[model samples]
Target: MTASLLDRLMDLETAVSYTTPPPEGERPFTYQAGDLPILISAPHATVHQRRQREKGEEEFTGALAQLLAETTGVHTLYSCYRSMDDPNWDRVSPYKTTLQEIVQSRGIRFVLDLHGMSNRHRFGLALGTMNGRSCPHFEPLILQTVKEQFQQTSQGTAKSYEELRWNHFVLNHARFTGGVANYTVTRFAAEQLGVPALQIELCSSARVVERRPLSQWRAPFRGQPDAIHQAVILLQSLVAVLQAAI
Candidate 1:
């Protein structure tokens, strides 16, 4: 990765965490214009109200989306402020509405939703494509590319990239089949808007440092350079795969 890219990602990591939420009536997510037909997104980048309850931020996801946009020249939509609506879970989310408008107006063909899971989660990354229902044409390619990139980047790590192959936890799996949750951004994009979409659930070891009172608050990489480096690698792999696929 270029120093500039890493530096920019570092800056974004801080920005996403410390930035003040916009006043009510203002959109929480910011759209980064791009010429590519692919759109990168991070719906849970910050805390949000979901199903009448507050949900914790997903840690570096917004920065990851921004990094992907910078590296791959793809359109991006990321949550920059605390969400008033659960973009991924709400049935009528303004995020999705705006997504539809962008897909239609910009002729976007792919939507990649990035998320982060705590270290408590078993897998390093879990890819969701609405259980094979979303992005019928691009799911296989997306899945294959992610697997290959993981194997290449995580060869000697504690997590065995090869083992992940047999785990088969990435797409249409039990924990997050992207099925039954039609309100999810990916499901809505595929089912309603007719655009292919996928949700990538990343484990925190690669992106975050969970703090006290775990539910709705935690810090991003903060002072941890290693965490940031790993996140950068993940973003680079994702951008490489996406560019190839696109």
Candidate 2:
């Protein structure tokens, strides 16, 4: 975590990817990976507290993990387990800001906003549009990658996921109910900030990268090697594509 964020946070962190806890269920602040040209974020990945919206408790978390992929190269890392207090989102949100400052200073290639949606809900990840969040070029790229990913999941052509993830939550237009609702961070980071953003909403029950069982994807469980490996792989691939386009 960056000194700037740590100074303003009441969160705790550890070497363990999932062991640390926050004073208010809010994860620690990070920004060391802030220098990376690319970013990977997970905003809806809270620790699963009982009171998701307690007076001072928000329940969503996210990250900027391009550093994990481009560790040796030029990349960054910023992930937050905000309890609905998306640091990358509205100022009204309680979480402090980090991503916006990094983008304003760094030539960020792409902003990957990672998240997970519920089957109980009607949609999958809400890959938010970059229209009002960042630059104009960010819009088409963000939309296309999400659509292509959805198409791959829906089709039998995808080999990594083992089974086709053609669940009803496939990418539809932004007009769908709460379509961009969950992706407000993406919008704010991309269009409003003039940086490209891609909101990645993975379904909690979606098939694993290796077609593994769905029981493993609950919460902070990303510590499991399988889940982390999957996240790393997809994150690396996406950054490569984003870098190429830039």
Q: TM-score of every model?
A: 0.81, 0.56
TM-score of 1: 0.81
lDDT of 2: 0.43
Query: How would you encode candidate 1's per-residue C-alpha lDDT over 6-78 as one tens digit per residue?
Result: 5666577665642356777778888999877889889888888877887778876887788778767889998
Residues 1-246 of candidate 2: C-alpha lDDT, one tens digit per residue: 233232212122221133234557444444555444776654434332223442211112232233343342434444333243444444444332566666667777666666555434544344444323443565566556556655644564435343223223343335422124543556666545656666565554331221112222434422222222333344555666677777
Candidate 2: list runs displaced more than 4 Å: 1-27, 34-36, 48-96, 121-125, 130-169, 172-183, 206-234
Question: TM-score for model 2?
Answer: 0.56
Show the lowest summed lDDT stretch of 10 residues, model 2.
Answer: 7-16
Among these predictions, the greatest TM-score belongs to 1
At residue 51, give the lDDT of candidate 1.
71
Question: Candidate 1's error at 209, in angstroms?
Answer: 7.2
Candidate 1 regions exceeding 4 Å error are 1-7, 17-20, 154-169, 209-246
